[model samples]
Target: MYDVSPVQLLIIAAAGLITSVIGGVAGYGTGALMPLVLVPIVGAEPVVPIIALSAIFNNVSRATLFRDLVDWRRVRLVILPALPTCALGAWGYTLLDGRGALVVIGSMLVLSVPLRRTLKGRGVTLGNGALATSAAGWGVLVGGTSGAGIILISLLMAAGLEGAAVIATDAAVSTVMGVLKFGVFGVSGVITAQVVAVGLLMGVIAVPGAWLAKRLTERLPLRVHTAILDAVVITGGAAMLFRAATF
Candidate 1:
């Protein structure tokens, strides 16, 4: 377990609080942003599990706040394939070195931006089968990495969801994925006492952030939300890559 000073603890909690607000709006910024703060403090080895554990609280808050808006059909579509595939990804995560996992996580975030813009411009749409296949791929990445939520947001947007529905549905799916990751990491001995403690603290502190985001979402324009999301993804991904390279 890595020892954290009170100041570092404050930083981590603050990160959760801040990112959860963005996540509440975008359905993704927490995972994309939190690691940029965490990996350096705790090192890469425990960051994924820590974030996964913390995400349970963050997602639950969003899912609950936006319960009425959740697209259950889309939730089922993503979760069905993600269930088995995410387990496989978690298993795979156990085999990767810290640098490899960080690189993968970083690369996924960076690449997803261009991919999202391209797909948006092309106006590509996925049918059920294709959507399921894409969910499976996301399952693997999300199970193993820190920033795969952006990809899910893109997929949901492409599937015709907008505004609250996108955030709500993504939260529902992500909540389940977080539970799955927690179990896998727990059983695999990846979740240590320090991880649990930090995760719980961060999660609790983020609750208000989620509430705040819900309020903001009602007023925020979709175009503004999209722009902020892209900026965060790019910056977070670049930071992770820089850390991995230096490591």
Candidate 2:
């Protein structure tokens, strides 16, 4: 059911190990990094499903690792709006061509960095209603694309969730999103045996990476963490945009 060569599988395993660690620390990396590897192997059509499937394990690990810090209130706020919109977004994703979705994902990623910084500098924040409204919009984007977790990270940061709180809350919300996306994909016949098998394999291999990140999160300075997250988001976003443009 899967087309990946043994060599490609090896490469994916390595990427999975690395990106999971990054996800553990930054609250979002697996989705951003996996597509860079998966798109060429699985093609664009399956990349989102694959990411969504694997993400169930990835976020589960992170949420568990950071369970002590997760803000259940924020999780509730984000999930309430994100759930219904995500279903719509998944349906909408079936309508978009590969390049169209890539363009949307890339644009959102690139724009999010500056948007976040500007908001922080001015002390701007969203009330619950505004947050729910924004979550509705993000639900659509995330449902359709890989690497869209940065959107949630940005939203959480804007809402005054700093450092560990941001990662923990993002993880909780992403866990639910992962489950929702999986259901949508499964019902749509997008989740094949190969996808599930590969996703689970990568997920198990990624556990150590999350463990390492969990240890580091406590030691890393807040500004350093923020900078790393921003840099990764921008670089990943730029890569997506470049790929989309070339495609």
Candidate 3:
């Protein structure tokens, strides 16, 4: 376990609050920001569990705020394909080094935007087998990379979801993904007691931040919120690529 100073803890808490707000509003940015912000403070080895915990807390808050807007049909569409694949990816993650995983994750982040745009307005019907395969791909990718939520969110947006429905359903699906990832991390011995404590402390800060963002999203202009979300995603993707190159 790495030792975090009081000042560093404060910084992390502040970052967590900001991350939570972005995630609550957009349902994507927090996970992407976690590695960039927390790894230096807590050390790289501890980042995975911290991200997993934060994802769970962030999604929980988003789900609560937009419970009424959740789209079960779309949620099922993504998860049915993503869950099993995520588990397999998680298993593979434990067997591989961080650098290899980072390369794949970074590439995925960079490509996700164009991929989403290409699929937009296609109206491809996803049957059970197709859904499962897609979900599995997402899961594996998510399990391997810290920013899977961004890819999933882009796909959902491309599928024509809007407003609270997108946020709520994304939160619901992320909740499941986070929980499963947490279990995988535990089984892989990556989640230590110190890591859990720090993650939970960060989560406590995230809850209020998520609530504030949810309230703001209710009142703010949709274009402004979406613009901010897009900026965050682009920033995150760039950061991931940088890390892949340097780490």
lDDT of each: 0.85, 0.80, 0.74
Better of 1 and 3 by TM-score: 1
Candidate 3 Cα outliers beyond 4 Å, as residue runs:
101-105, 113-132, 219-247
Model 2 ranges with Cα > 4 A deviation: 220-246
Superposition error at 98 for model 1 (Å): 2.4
- Per-residue alpha-carbon lDDT of model 2 for 3-34, expressed as tens digits? 88889888888989988888887777678767
Name the best candidate (by TM-score): 1
- lDDT for model 3 comes to 0.74
Error of 3 at 83 (Å): 1.5
Best by lDDT: 1
Winner on lDDT (2 vs 3)? 2
Clashing pairs in 1: none
Between candidates 1 and 2, the TM-score winner: 1
Worst 10 residues of 3 by lDDT: 120-129
Which parts of model 1 have CA positions greater than 4 angstroms off? 221-225
Candidate 1 vs candidate 2: which has greater lDDT?
A: 1
- Model 1: per-residue lDDT, tens digit, 87-155? 888878877788887887788779878887887788878777877899999999888887788889888
Q: Please provide TM-scores, in order, for all candidate models, with all chains considered together.
A: 0.94, 0.87, 0.84
